[model samples]
Target: MPATCQVRVLGGFGVTVDGSPVPAHAWRSRRAADVVKLLAIETGHRLHREQVMELLWPDLPVEAAGANLRKAVHYARRALGGPGAIAVDGQVLALWPDGCLDCDLERFNRDADTALASGDARACAAAAARYGGDLLPDDRYEWWAEEPRARARSRYVALLRAAGDWTRLLELDETDEEAHRAMMRRHLAAGRRREALRQFERLREALRERVGVGPDAETVALYETALAEGAEPPSVEQTVAVTLANGLVAWGRRNVEEAERLAKRARALALDAGLGHELGEASTLLALVAYARGTWHEQFRQEFADSVRRSANLENAVFDAHLCFQEFYLYGPEGHEGAESFGRDLLGIATAADSTAGRALAHLLLGEFALLSGHLDEARAHLDLSLTDAERAGCLSAQSIALERAAETQVRRGDRRAAAALLDRAMPLAHSSGIRSHLVIRIHGLRVLAAGGLVEALGAVRDGERLLAEATHVCDPCSMAFRIEAARACVRANDLGRARRHLAEAERISGLWQGGPWSAALWEIRAELRRATGQTTQAAALFLEAAELYSTLHRPLEEDRCRGAAGVR
Candidate 1:
């Protein structure tokens, strides 16, 4: 009995006969495999000899290439164990129909196209899986293989995406920006905002690194929509919580005016509804705005405390969790032990409730606390977990914040390359969500720290200063940090006038926040400026003050650095 001919071309080019492998040496001529692949993939498994000859040996004369084609055909037939396997007419070559020629590429195309046309997602998914890799991956650079391979891969990706098999599509083509965008949209639709935002970042990096281009306008617009306030209030009574959450989202994106307006509206709605939880949430948001606007430290502190008490008394778990998270932001660095306790409580509540956003925020608080305490490895682990939770929950705002903190951790670990890579991945998502100001300023400050030259560092400081001046909430903690960093950068550049101005501004902001983390940074920069200007005694005093603040914050590494700077043990 004649052998059955089987061809596999999806992952690689291969031929078998009667369920037996064709020995590698049997088709020693490179063109033999090429001939078999071409014949199998061609319409009706047939192609004109001249066409095959042209594709396989365009460098040779027509007659010489024809001779080579004949030799290749003979080898192919022998490899298939019979001349009848590949029959040649006067001008055409074909896999003999009677030979029971079966090809995976042909079957994949037929099933995928049919399933797509029928809108059968399950069938399409099954067909798409058959495409294990690019068509004839080994022949990737061959001109003859390009068109069909691309067509197969594109169809496979489209089918997988349509079937909601994002993982498989990504596995097939990691550099496919469209696939990434589709998956991002899917994640967002499923309420996984952090995952969506992370996908956008991955797409941005892949496009930039692989193709030297950014995402198209469509992708950016979609991300912007994802970042926008999307809650729909089902009734007037429910408007307060929806509006409050929207206000929080706006604030996260640094839209101060919009946040304030939404927060005020939410408060009004809460009062009308007589909902204690709504009122508490609204109050918390308003307090955050006040703190960000550089309100007096005592006033902000009292307001936050009042909000927390009200939220706790409401006996609302969600509202209480929100209040606890806010408290951590307000005093977490200065009171690490308290922050840890609150974080653990929030984590427990969120886990029990299966609230992805709450868990993400809890992890972020813990991560930031760990990072501040100089526990680098622990901080990294916490940040990673925070990012994971945020992604799974589809919280873009939390994802962006976690990514920034992760980059900061990398910077502290003295990995400029890793830090830059992280920032590069983060900036696009931040921009998409309209939260780029603070992150951009931080990036500029990081550049100052990492720059090799005084000139470069000074330039970065100027950029950071410009961003701070343009920010909607210039008194935010990050803005204050930017000012201190700018002052230090200017001091290093010997630009005394700008350094003094930035230092004075930082001091003014620090005065509003009192003994917060920014105060330590402000004093450290002041000490540096004083030391540079020959004010040794004042510098020593400022350094000691900074050291004490760091000690209070439980940042022993920073405290020791300050003590050393002050000429103490």
Candidate 2:
């Protein structure tokens, strides 16, 4: 029988065999102990011999490292008690092969994954409590441990924030300004002005001691208001901000009419107040309403052009960046004249303004610009930058958008597995941005479907269609994209009935807007649909038509792909 192994690495590192601590003197060498430690921290407590040698003895020659790994494995087995304690099959090594291991990091990950997937507050609190501290604090300098340590620490902090455990968070990191601000806001929101003031002072002390800087402008503004004491009438900026925020909430909840009303009100208030920043925000909100209603090109320019120009002249980087994103997002960039230059100009503005959010969205625009121009590598680089900037900016919607675009690039490059992983991470963030609506969620469902087993594709098809039926937006372009992908997926699954229906809806939507990617997409999918139905000559013609449209869009990769399919036909 295999011995039960208990490994703890959250706060520190230790191992127990059958509930008894392994005596320190029992270990033959420090490297032997380190070998056990490394394996215990890795996924499923397993690593191939080559990888283990690379991580543990990268400087040594291959033969010498392999010899050392053998000795280490032998010592590790003796230290843990019994050959079954550590298993080696050929070149693969794993700790506790009998599934008798009790690992704190594993427990914490399970709890954290559950909490994140469910979005339950109580679950988050439980996961936060389960985190004993940083992972393997004693091994902080180990290169191999750094990634897992940082990942665990990040998850713990996110859980703490979600659970509203600010006090505990402050105990963990004294200079956490965001945590302090959250405490201050809670106190002020509850009419406890004195408490809010005290919180701000605590934050100021922490900042001065740790970073040697004063509070930032936003915090300072809040502090001044705290000094005056809570519960005053909402000011002009406050009113506009509130209105726009509520509009966002309404949009997320699919109450488009209410969102439109709030957007209009916010715009009117900002215009009357003559606040450039608020006016910029207000104009974007109106633009968002127009987008939700699928009249962006027709309604947006006429209704919001002067306000947008005014905001840009006022140097509102966020406003300028968002307006650029809207155009690129709707039209797919390169097909529209001057779109690439517009994105470059916005990127320059965002950089000069030092606005992380502006930079994030600007990069997203350029990434899409690159993507539509068939520059998959360039698109991926831009999207990666966007994701990093978005995370630093602490904006969920921006992060989600960046992740989705990155996933799209992966799918285009025929890496559906990578696409699936990204979409999984993007789902929760997209929820708060109203993009988790069926309209957007189902758009990439086919990629995820492709990631599943080919034999199981039909099951995924049903699931994807269920999501498709829940569409909650009037955006024709979005619907067209979703249906085309759905049609493609269905054709692969040999479900031509569903394929034809999806293609029909997609065709109807494409007819609304003249020749573009949608038309190209429909032609490509219809070719496949025709092929599935044994119409070989007609399918060849449709594929050629699709290739021509793809060429017009400068999508050389896609054009070549369609042309190849035509050749095959």
Candidate 3:
């Protein structure tokens, strides 16, 4: 009822009824609550007076029913705390959007519609999460209340799942027996079997205590089967969903098999689904898995070709464009003309489609390429655009990733303090969103820490190792990245044996990954390690190889590093 009223319908129908919070003493009648609920759920705050009278007094004669409806409206206004809350305009009864009644349902509905139109999961999740619980739980028996209830429930289920907020969903609706069962299936789909069973048990106990009933048959059976199986790995589809999330968990651990398995499964699923946004998710995840393992070139070519051939809808088309930008960043050259060209094409399409994720992605990629190519000022502009869009869209994972990349660029250009501050802001957001790419960023952050002398004497070394270990556990590990940092950390610690081992591993992975900005750095790092370990001949050979690769790739900074490491500076 106040200006820009706040209503949260998701948890329950909570409303600021006419510029005031409905005090406990005010909600004395179910009919009064029902009246407000009815009008709030109507389209455009408009409802017919005759229809309301019929609903409130079905069997009364017309004259008596009219009297009853008027009385009900009067009392409802009083309960809402003012006469200004509701007014009759001839044959119509309406709640003013700005005055005595603001409904969360209306806000949720509006946000959900916008998100659905845009096909952005984060926006959808934010909108859907506003629906706290059953609408008008205090007046659930009213027949007219079912429509808003159903709409809220459906949106919650769809958006929560899409946003991968399984734990939150379970928490919000543990006693909703149907939702509990559905959550089990979702957890299983996401490859979280333990969590699935735990949720089911919680629901079962809650149902038992609250209503003297066990879990629904479907929920019980799912629990039984999953328990009997004793924690098998997730299904291919579920595994793919998790792995597409970026990097493996834990310190210096990678789940290469799982990442590969999930990507493969996603591909199969995509093929079966065909021509839709879901299929595009699969395609993009596969590309990400490829990029994570440093084998993106061939996969990128294949996916780009496939995307160009497809005539999908706006959502799917935009997703495909996002994939191209990611590919260009990971596999294309530094200050990559190719990436920039592809990015322009993709960004244009995303703009036309009004795809928030696509636009954020394009900006992030373009910024990263620009930064690597010595265009730091341009990088800052693009990265800011990326962060702004990501924040507005509520895509925390995308936002964190962009921030981390931007922080790296900042650190490289004598802005160490700013870079650290960015990392601090980004870490929690990244962890909450389950974004594995943060591992790579954190490792880079450690370099800034060492350079800034902010870390303990051996802190950076230990932290670097831990991050590398986690990266390995998730997929085909970023073995080269792990090695480059591990080698540097070890050298700093004066551990020559470990340093050589790490350098050797870096060399192996670099050879496997072939030419790229990162791989070239790996080679140069290996050369430095070799030179430090008194393997002068080997160091010269590795440095020469690295320089040749860097020159071919037009990366003078890296070529210079290789020459310096070879003692030819």
Candidate 4:
């Protein structure tokens, strides 16, 4: 019988066989033990022969590396008690992952993912506890180890955030400003006014001690708020801010009526206060509420412009520019042409301000523009920049959004495998700490891939669909868009009944934009179903109608495709 192997690679590297530690002298060489380590980190305890050789002995000649690889495997096998423990399959090396192996890396990943997907505090705590430390601290300099180590650290931090284990986070990274800020927020929220101040002091001391810098502007703002301590009446700006904050929270909950009511009140208060800045923010909020309601008033664009004009007197113009861009992007049907200008404006302001977070947003918008305009190369460049900036700034939200856009670009470029891999990378990030909208986008991509015939994505679609069902109130148009994709996917799978159901659901909410892109999509998909069901004439007519709609929307590629589709038998 084979001796069971227990592998531990989080924080440190160690192995035991049959409940006893494998001594250093057991392996023929360190390189041999590394062969096992390499395989242990992988998803299925496997790596291609070339991959193993390149990683382990990148400086050596291939022939030499191959010989050394064989030698390492031979020695590692003997140390681990041979055949049942490891083997080479054709061009790949694999560790036996049956009853013979128990890997902490796998267990930690599984538990962490479970917690992330659920967002349950208890689950987060459990997962955080399971994370002994960073993955393979000894191999910190290794390129392959770096990614897994960073991923593990990110997930651990996310878990700590969810569990409110600030001490643990600080223990792992004393210079983590986010952890410190989160602690401050917790203190403030709990009415621990003095503690909040003390927390801020701790952050100030830590930053100065560790990096010789002061707290950021945002952190200082929080500190000032804590310092106020009801010493004076709330200013008009503060009062307006509270109202707008409530309205925004209402909007997030999909309570459109309540949000609209609160927005109106906020606008009144701002007007009474005679503050142009707050007025601009209030107007922007109202426009957002209207957009969420899927019924933009006639002056929507004017409202956004007026808001920006109102905010121009302020030193920080990024806020108003972002508000305008955000609202215009929502009205995709009529305001599509204007989105680029606002995006450019945002990018310019962000660039001038030297704001990494702003540049990340700007690049994200530009990337979307390029992707939608059918410029794959431009899209990739913009999205790549967005990811780089987002990562550099430590903005996980921006990172997740950029990944989503990049994955979509990959899908459009006909690289389903790359799209799937990108989404795989995004899933954990989104699940851990991302907003509901972010998760929806990630899930939407997964389901789209599944519909595009990526079989592996099929397994993940159910969870995605479940989350979508709960998030219908987030963005009505988004709901219809996802359903359109799902319907098309179902049709591709030849599941006509399911497709029709999805189409009906989408069309139910599409009454607001009867001739928009989504309406055009419904026409094209209906044509597909008709053609699938042997109604050729009906299908062609629908195709022509969709082509006409696409032409009206300035979608030349989609128009051309639909036109060609109309003539396809």
Off by over 4 Å in 3: 1-281, 284-329, 332-337, 437-450, 454-457, 467-472, 475-482, 535-541, 565-569
Per-prediction TM-score, please?
A: 0.46, 0.48, 0.46, 0.48
User: Which lDDT tens digits does candidate 1 get at residues 16-65?
Assistant: 78888788788878888789888877879889988998787764579898
Best by lDDT: 2
Positional deviation of residue 121's Cα in model 2 after best superposition, in angstroms: 41
- Stretches of candidate 2 above 4 Å error? 1-265, 268-281, 284-337, 446-460, 471-476
What lDDT is obtained when candidate 4 is compared to the true structure? 0.69
Candidate 3 TM-score to native? 0.46
Error of 2 at 249 (Å): 20
Which residue segments of model 1 deviate by more than 4 Å? 1-335, 434-443, 450-453, 471-475
Whole-model lDDT values for every prediction: 0.69, 0.70, 0.60, 0.69
Choose 3 or 4, whichever is better by lDDT: 4
Better of 1 and 2 by TM-score: 2
Question: In candidate 1, how many Å is residue 53 off?
Answer: 83
lDDT of 3 by residue, 1-569 (tens): 34444455455666663355766557566556566667877876767888887776664568997887777778777766566677777788877544534567767777777877787878877877676676666544345665777777787777776666766765665566666777778778888878887776567445432332334435545766666566465554433333333222210135656645654565555555453433455455455557677776566545544443443332333343243345345544452546676666657756765766557766877886786566788988999998987787666656776787787777667787788778777777755642244244444434534356524424655555555433323212323444566566666555555566567665665564445765666666676667666788998988888887777776666677777767777
